[model samples]
Target: MSVQSESVTDTGPEQTVGYTLHGNRYLNITNRCTLRCAFCPRFNDEWTVQEYPLRLRRDPSFEEIVLAVGNPEEYQEIVFCGLGEPTLRLYTLLEVATRLRPHARRIRINTDGLANFVYGRDVTPDMEGLIDALSISLNAQNAEIYNRHCRPKLPGSYEAMLDFVKVAREFVPDITLTAIDGLSGVNIPACKKIAQELGVKFRRRVLDVVG
Candidate 1:
């Protein structure tokens, strides 16, 4: 089931609903998140990602998001990414992705892998055929280190995220677990090993780098 959250109206014309990076068109739907990572730009009082301001005064509607992607075929991939977790606005993400499926070469989402814990259900099935790739933030080697850096808002988030990966693979085809390399206490090799053990791919992300 989709999350029933309040709608935030777009009050101005200057709000950045979309941005382009590395041949990919990215969508900024909402600013809500399930985790407050110590290294996240927003948490550090920085709102810009690669010089594009991502502080959303209000979340965009499905129509607004669709309008932001003027030509889906112009980019290599259509990515649902911003300073926040895309899954928090799962309904809007799915609606926009579904609308762009025919024209886009690929559709991807950068997330924290906590949708199931947030929605309290197996939401991966809803991503079938709509999303082509998932880049999940693994962040740490173990729950203690994960909790220290991610500072997840919900209980059992570390375990829930792992569970999401296990279940998500059955629906989404390209799933990669990612962990930041430079953060204190973050062991890159161990993190990659966990992803290997989980039967998924892994990536080492640099601190403060978007995409």
Candidate 2:
């Protein structure tokens, strides 16, 4: 369904259980991104994932997030996920997540793994107790392929991204590093090796193409 067609201002809750969608509430922090991955749909205004449209407006305020999650106890997880990197608004996200924590069964943050450069500080340490699960995008095995595919805006961003994952594992026990299949010359074995080094779980997701 289209986000415009749906009630974008809907603050009502949809309760569910056991890893279900539970009508996930996503916040589009900023459309501007540091990475322009070859497979990224940042330029596409009509992107959709699992029926949740990725069309985004300007960055939202803490109050907007509070209102968006009128009642958080309804969803299985209050996720910080959207078309852009959530950590770009590190302070705002932490505020929102902390407020929703009391009501949410779980809190998760899906990121592109470049928070350090974006925020100019080590962002993971601040999220220790605030976030439940941290899912990061590790789309390539080596720096060469990673740079080619991810097109990160910062220098040494590939290495920095890996470092972010390593550091996050120290605080967040449930850290998962994921990659999109068939894009970055990423092999399962290599990804598993990287995850093993970082002491985190690795997953390969099927890339969805919109017609």
Per-model TM against the reference = 0.93, 0.84
On residues 1-211, what C-alpha lDDT tens digit does candidate 1 reach at each position?
1211111212364367787777777888888899998888888888877766678888888988888787899889888987788899998899899889999999999999999999999999999999999999999999999999999999899999999999999999999999998889999999999999999999998877777
Clashes (backbone N, CA, C under 3 Å), per candidate, total: 0, 0
**Which residue window of length 10 is worst by lDDT in model 2?**
11-20
Measured by lDDT, the strongest candidate is: 1
Model 2 regions more than 4 Å off: 2-23, 209-211
Q: Write the per-residue lDDT of candidate 2 for residues 70-174, one digit (tens) a residue.
A: 677766667776666778788888998888877787788888889987777888889888898888888788888888888888889989999888788877778
Minimum summed lDDT over a 10-residue window in model 1 is located at 1-10
The CA lDDT of each predicted structure is: 0.86, 0.71
Q: Candidate 1, which segments miss by more than 4 Å at Cα?
A: 1-14
* TM-score, prediction 2: 0.84
